[model samples]
Target: MSGPKYLGHLNINVRNVEISHEWYTDLLGLHTYDFIPGRAAFLSANVELSHEIALTQVAEGAPGLQPGQVGLGHFAWRVETLDDLKEFYQKLLDRDIKITPRDHGVSMGLYFQDPDGNGVEVYYERVRADWYTQENIFTNEKRPVGDFPGPWDELAAD
Candidate 1:
């Protein structure tokens, strides 16, 4: 059977609204458009698109995300520029967010946990469509950080 309709916005249950809100804004460059106290918050990109992320506070004493959980492993947000990913990764490091950088065959990505230990990925697609083939499926092979050179330096020089 074919997949259903496209994915809409994501609703994440976070531990703290203000903290998660700030972290997402800084790391992903999302802007807050609406906030409902003790209930939920909605954020979107600076562009004309509608809300892309929604945060709802979980009940008190609820267990947060754990490795090998049953549902919602992680979600990715694509970036147009490698420099944006680099800059945001640095900012996350500065804020003491646990970041794990990886280079998928077709993409460069930075993995970090949110304030509530929910894994989040901000990635840039590096491989052109023409490069992909049936023989080479882009697998998540572990590699050294910084091994995949981002295009930031080249873009900045121009």
Candidate 2:
């Protein structure tokens, strides 16, 4: 008989599951489908997948996250265009979320912190698989928007 296989949900332990629950739901636009008060909450990106994110409330007096810890680093959500990313960048700034924008050779990314200080990245890929190249590995070196060309200049004129 064939076996079922899949990468299941991601579970995160948060200081206050309720607050983190609300944050993820509001920020990422996920919906909470299940909840165990004072313990955990399961959130779904859509109706199909069981749960994309699960949050468990840490016991009272538990220690908070320490920097440089060996665990989950960050997660990214991809957008379609640089203009879309720019829109979100402004929205995040208006919300006073700490944000850092970067132009990866293959993508444009915005990094920021959630309420819990968890690193999150929202990005837009510049090139498709057919366009990627070995010579253009994205480096941490910064390049402001004025320094590089944007793809939508012609489209914007109309």
Clashes of each: 0, 0
Residues 1-158 of candidate 1 have per-residue lDDT tens digits of 98878666899998778777887877677988888877788988745656888999877567987678898888888888877787767676667777777766567888877878777888887657633443445442432335355554453344
Model 1 worst lDDT window (10 residues) = 136-145
TM-score between candidate 1 and the true structure: 0.77
TM-score on alpha carbons, each prediction? 0.77, 0.73
lDDT of 2 by residue, 18-88 (tens): 88888888777788889888899998766687787788888766776578998778777777787877776
RMSD of 2: 5.5
Q: Candidate 1, after superposition: displacement of residue 86 in Å?
A: 1.8
